[model samples]
Target: MSDTLSPKAAKLHNRTLITTYLYEHKEATKQVLERELGISLPTITQNLRNLEAEHIIELGELQDSTGGRKAQSYRFAAKHRVAIGVALRSNSVCLCAVDLYGDTVQERTHAMSYTNTPMYYQRVGTLINEFAATVAKGGSTVLGVAFSVQGIVSADGTSITFGTLMHNTGLTLETISQSVHYPCIMIHDSDASAMAELWFDPTIRDAVCVYLERRPGGAVIVNGKLYQGPNQCNGAIEHMVLVPNGRQCYCGQRGCMDTYCSLETLPEEGESVPGFFSVLEQGEPHHRERMHTWMEFIAQTIVNARSVIAGDVVIGGEAAQYLDDSDIAALKSRVQQLTPFSTDTFSLHKSRCADTNSIVGAALRYIEAYVDSICTDAE
Candidate 1:
């Protein structure tokens, strides 16, 4: 077959290219776009006009010229449409509004607890709608809402296939989407966190993301994509057994990694992870010992995971933010001692979106969908 671009395909390709460049660079002039994209000046102007008419792009102040008339600048209207992401936890909910560029525009937390009853679902729907209403007041379109649940999500993102922690197993997407006046979907919290990492750093071809939250969970990225297993539980690393007949995990598993490496593992009876870290930083002997054990367990888990999947390990979630440089060095040393090969073969990375990975990732689901729809449109 001949390698040629049809007129329609070329138009679509140019539009996508121009829009993507503006989105990435924030702003550009018609001449700059023409020069950078290698498109004809008229074609660049036409695409810019179309984008501006659609409210996807807007005009910016003219740039100063060296020896000619000032050139008009165009900018991508990143916040023209926003996506909402909700993270449902056992005791509270986190709501975030993200723009097309995956930047969080607004975020809030609610003290509501999770209950599988219809009333609870209705309340969640109401909260989402109310939040959207506030966001819409800024004259921005609300594209959709995505829920990040700490459970196994169905392949179609329509139901919670496994949610023992929140007792929300079998919950359907419609239960909450019904009250909200926009597109919606369900997503696994770990999966969403992994997506956020991929969005933040597209270079991650293959890696393991371990979320050291109160209840540890993880996701796997294979070949630059999420590897959902047959049961869509490919990255349920928390359930991996670390010891036989040891401490019980919340999932009722004995000696699971969650019981040893989770943030919950470091805290005292009423101390939070932050409090535990605070004392640990102060050189308290008890906290120091607990953190040492925690790092050892985490190192072992990373080594075990690498034995099956070879890639960088990204440590994320609420607890990961507390990990300082010294902590990373200690963990790296521990991991090096466990592996036969050199530690230089693999690497450990701290999550850039430590606190908001799941929330941002959840919202990015719809933002990406919108961009895909635009880029894939043939007409």
Candidate 2:
């Protein structure tokens, strides 16, 4: 077997290395890239030229030189391609366009009840096409559209296997893709939120995202990657039983963690998550007690989950903004009391991308795919 890569393979590898570096650093000179990436100056120049031709990279103003000639700076054109993310809720839809750097270029939320009819899906697709056209006004390519739904998505990303919140189970991507021009896929909201968390903090290797929205959900990250498991249901923590023969869950289970830890139950009828937390913070005795009881259930759930997968935990979603240091401390104390292992092994924190995480994460799928295609010569 040959020890060295073929010329074509070497070219692809060098281009991947150079592009990856520029994607991270945002800007670099040919000389700087050659030195830092340890590639030949000729190879760097050729790759940069190719990228410029494709509009993936652009030439910038000359750098101020300390000596003779000023080196020309090359900038990664992040907005050359844009990914569309659609977050489908029970009564509204959140749409956002994201660039290569995972920054939102445009975002909007529209009030519309979800119905599993072809007309409804076609309307959603029409809205996405309009959004894509607006994003494309600046000459950016519309990469694809990703739908973040509240359910378990199949590994193929074509259909929702388990959706109850919006009654969208069995919905196929083709239904929406028919009216839209771009490629499309469906993603579970919890997994989508986890992707956003990963983008916000790339250093996280192993962790669990405890999504405390209207319905409790979770995502598991192992070895710095989302673990969908064989059934694509590895992180379905909502159905984890907490109390036997207790309140029934939407999944037809009794005392599942969702029945107890859901933020939906924390707020009173017609009260918002913020309103409930505000009253709790105002020294309301009953509200405070209610929060305490909720925290106990949340801590119990965390400890139970940690017993199987000993990773750091992040509490996120709609209610994440309301959690304070005191709440975290209380949860930690309770977790310590319940945990069989030392709580010091795993740390806990609140979510940084609370509300926008799912939308951003959904769009990231396309962004990541575009990068991989370029790096692997798939394009």
Candidate 3:
């Protein structure tokens, strides 16, 4: 027999290659796919037709051909599937629906406290059902659900190893998954935010994402992936001791970074992050001094972290949106001073997703898995 792939195997391989290419490139013409995939025109046309029939790919605008006939471009129909992301906080739940393209098409906040009671889980399930109904369009399917919680999540996303906010430990995936019909996963809030940053900016292959929200925390990205330590506590930056005998952290640690760098440190009179930043922007001597001191502590933390992890530092969360370029520059300068080895400027970046990073990242988990599953099956 001739050495060739069986008809069925070849078709599946072509479909997988074409879909993966379009997913990465966003859109491509038949000719482009043929050339990039090293597949013949007939095979490309056949696979494209099959994918289009399955509502996976769709024809786009005609591309300008150098010669006679124009070519038709094809793109992945990203909105064909959706994923739900629920950020379970201490007193509120942020539910968001994201499409395959990582767009948050629908979102809403429901007021509820996190608890271990069955009633609470049932309430969350009801809210999820209602929200899914509201957000899912006629042709789109809910692929899965991801939960971003303020706690230490298991490596497999099946349970919460520890949670300080809920004062609970060993919270299993069944608690939330039983309420929703779709497959579910649980992730630490900081890790989700880090994933959001990585998804929004492809250039950031490795970095430490610092979240300065109501409760400060961090996530470490290694080789373009979240690095949960062997114990699943890799990015607990909040508990890092910044001062030898400073303010007390909720974790019962003295002089932790959370006590110094969190949003809680902002003056209460401002009422909100924007208002607090506004006060600092007004050029008041004391307010400016306070901000300067805060930046110093933040810089100190970055220097300390860099010495261990050696990657770019990304500042994110509610407070990140209020920080201007000058503020980042100031923080960078402080870091440069504190660091002894390199005179070069440290690689620092601001978060692109702002307040919605965790929720968006949560949704992306399922979207990413869906795509990976296709590739895996092809293999």
In the range 1-379, model 3's lDDT, one tens digit per residue, is 1127787777677778889899889899988998898988998898888889988888898988788898889988887889999987788988999988899878899888778778888888888888887766557789988898889988777888877667767888997678887788888888888888888887887788888887888999999888988778988888899998889777877999999998868776636766677878888788778787888888998888888888899998877887889889888888888888875454897888857889889889998888787654353
lDDT per residue (tens digit) for residues 317-379 in model 2: 777788888788778778888887652577789987847889899999999888777656432
* lDDT, each prediction: 0.86, 0.85, 0.83
Full-model lDDT, candidate 3? 0.83
User: For candidate 1, lDDT tens digit of each residue in 1-379?
Assistant: 0127878778888898898888879899998998898888998989989999999999998999989999999998988999999987878878999998899888889999778788887788889889999998987899999888888988877888888887778888888566777888888889999999999899999898888888888999999988878789998989999999999877888999988987877989999878888888889999988888888889999888887888989999887789888788788778888988863577787887758789899889899988777655456
Each model's TM-score?
0.95, 0.93, 0.91
Residue pairs clashing in model 2 are: none
Q: Can you tell me which runs of candidate 3 are displaced by over 4 Å? A: 1-6, 62-71, 343-345, 375-379
- Could you tally the backbone clashes for each prediction? 0, 0, 0
Better of 1 and 3 by lDDT: 1
